[model samples]
Target: MAKQLIFKTKYTEHLKEAVSSGKSLEFYKSKEFVYDKKQVLIMPNIEAFPNLTSSLDIKDDFKTAVQIYEAFKGLEPIQASDERFWTYLAHVDLFLYMIERWPEVYVGKSSNPSKYLLDHWFISSSAQSSLLRHAISGLWWSVYLSVDEAKGENKYGLTKILFRQLDFPTRTLGTYKLGRHKEAVLGILEFIQENEDLFKTKFEDKTRFVTKHLNVVGGVKPIAYYDRQFFKSELEKVSGNISAI
Candidate 1:
């Protein structure tokens, strides 16, 4: 267990500028961009946090999310949303993980490496889209939104389903407002779990349909105020429709 640390605001901005202007490319190539001790601020009253591990498959995001959530389980939503905290992790403790997971950015395969760095290595905003897009914070938020204690031993069942593929979190949930609500996310996952056969293939297309359908329903109704059951029922309405196509 170690004390949590975050980048000082000025350094955070400086790093962002460095990445954006392509000044950090050589450092990335050399694998030598280490954070200066003076640039970090230790968080008060927080401890027992461990460093994150890197994995090759997108499915491994579930494990990474669980690891991060357990380490910082007590974090308030506002604190978790802070860019300083996530940026520090991205640039420091999990720097290798970022490089391993996003090798294209460093290898120059990405058409716009600067934008890739800015998007994945930094927290762009407190918005759901931004939180879900960041390489590290996105993993934490995925578990945060979907973990259900009532599931007892299978608390992360929905989390597993969400990471069964990368697109569900990065594309589907990140792009939609419905993802901001826990109930909606759990409901969608529940629907998928209940009808596993339907989603065994074409998972991305079906999940996108589910989110779009629910978003339309949310427009006419206070879907956010409802529970997970409401989302399951709404999804069921389109189950037959999805099966036909």
Candidate 2:
């Protein structure tokens, strides 16, 4: 059996109470644990593994929390099925409360994200779709794959532009469909970043354009097998006439 956090579905209520009382996170502080900084981390008591929402970190800041979560992914030994996500949802959801409560470094949205966040916390039985719903799980996976050298020598730099591109991070990060082809996503991001000078469309527009190209190309070829050069070419052709570069 997969590790479970044993929250007994207290997640929604825990968050509800915390926000309802307007309390500082002092009451929610989790016990600190050292991150191994390896490809993965092991936390038998995942609940006590530190809070991602806390502005405070045992190491430093929010990014470190992200790093720790990414490492945890490798260690979790989860299966791809929807069932696996249920086992770990409580742990992941609890950690994200810190981010939602004190979103300065992370959420980048309104003070009370609960309006939108609650709906996403978890959907009916769709773990595949829940990637967008669960705060920690979605962002952690996105950052993990984004930093994992899909375009050689660590193109994690792309996230600076990628995440800022409106719904791009929320949509792209949570999506495992295109994720199987990381190079394709990286190639699209690389093109968007480089051509930011020539095109001045809304981030949502850019997302649509990229999604269209991906749907076409990904449907044609098994994108995971392609190299950077091939992915770039497909991105270039779909994007069309780069007058600047």
Name the top TM-score candidate.
1
Per-residue accuracy of model 2 over 125-183 as CA lDDT, tens digit each: 44545654344455554555456454565545665555564256556434546654656
lDDT (CA) per prediction = 0.81, 0.48
Q: Give, for candidate 1, the lowest lDDT window spanning 10 residues.
A: 48-57
- Compared with the true structure, model 1 gives a TM-score of 0.92
Candidate 2, residue 167: how far the Cα is off, in Å: 1.7
The segments of candidate 2 whose C-alpha lies over 4 angstroms from its true place after superposition are 1-48, 55-73, 76-118, 149-155, 172-176, 241-245
Q: Which 10 consecutive residues of model 2 have the lowest summed lDDT? A: 31-40
Give each prediction's root-mean-square deviation over alpha carbons: 2.0, 8.1
| Candidate 2 backbone collisions, by pair | 53-98, 53-99
CA shift of 183, model 1, Å? 1.3
RMSD of candidate 1 to true structure, Å: 2.0
Highest-lDDT candidate: 1
